[model samples]
Target: MKVKEMIKENNRLREQMTPFNRSYLEDMILVLRASRVDPLRTEELLLEAAQQMLIAQKKGNTATQVFGDDPEAYFKEVIETTPSRPARSKLNYYLMIPWTALTLLFGVMAIVGLISEWTTGSAGMFGQISLFTLLSVGLGSIIFIEMIMKWMSSLSDTDAPRVGKFNIKGFGVYIAIAVVVIYAGLYLSQLFPPFALSPWVSLILSIAGLLGLKFIFLK
Candidate 1:
């Protein structure tokens, strides 16, 4: 194919990929080029990778998850292990940032709201029901988002036979923490009522807390 045609085709293929997959493929290209793999062979490998990704998509998996943890690392390993010696070379947690930030924001808001209600003696059956619902949904969303991210990260381990088991221990820990937090809130309610903050003030505090946590850990 002509150079212009190849470039156009490559662009077309990239446009079809998910953002994560496109980033992976770009990184793989750089690694392969540095290793001095023959251009034709490199293209072949990349095409195969794209095809595999499409197959995975059909099977209800994202390219990132199918490719596993580090696509570039996996590709490098494949190149080194294969008999072909046309060249030599060496090679986020970031994707979860938005989800983590949002999760933390909702979580803090729910917790603070719950505590406020309890201390103010406003946590009657209906109030408690609403507060629990908010907490449950927020927690559930965070868990679901983390699971998807972790699953994609796990794909980095090429040798792992399966995606691994459901996190029973993690679930238990979460339950234990919830129980402790609720107990503390109840105890504090009896000792001292929480001062009421305006809705806007509560929102500001929640956002500030979220940003503080993000900076402390994610930064």
Candidate 2:
């Protein structure tokens, strides 16, 4: 073939492959991101894959065909097998010490305040409720932070599955648990006259009841 014809053919092939290449790389990135893979390692793997795909395309094979039917699964498998840098280094563990200290200090203060309020009977029903709510929020935040840390740490270990990603089943379970807890709290509050069920509490119960029904029946 003439040199001019060969050059034209190469340009045509590149133009045709550009969109498919972009799509494949994008899908691979999503898989890596979902798996919590290291950013630097993710980029290196993507570049290497792109180069290999381009070479295959130059040999007249479609990149999509080479990648096969399930590109995401294929890329995920690649990421799982390839060795990468540790997700959390010793420096990261050292940095968390201050955070741990702060959390412990806050927890102790919260417990002390709750005990003082309970003994004195100074805080009104609403005030006591607010304090309990604050405690729950603090605990929930700690749990969420721990989950994120675990997920980050697991990224380097191929044997450890991805963590912290939300699933519908998990979300449903959370909602159901929250509903049950709130309902139980309201039921128990009735046993104590000081925390009598107010109109607002009744309204909350009604809403929760509706949600519980929906969760059960809709699913």
Per TM-score, the best of the predicted structures is: 1
TM-score of 1: 0.34
Q: Tell me the RMSD of model 2 versus the true structure.
A: 17.5
Q: Evaluate model 2: give its TM-score.
A: 0.32
Give lDDT: candidate 2, residue 7.
38
Worst 10 residues of 2 by lDDT: 153-162
- lDDT score of model 2? 0.50
Per-residue alpha-carbon lDDT of model 2 for 80-99, expressed as tens digits?
77665465643443334434
Best by lDDT: 1
Which digits, one per residue and each the tens of the lDDT, describe model 1 over residues 123-165? 3332222333434444455455555644554332233345555
Clashing pairs counted in every model: 4, 0
Task: Give stretches of model 1 more than 4 Å off.
Answer: 1-7, 81-219
Q: Extract clashing residue pairs from model 2.
A: none
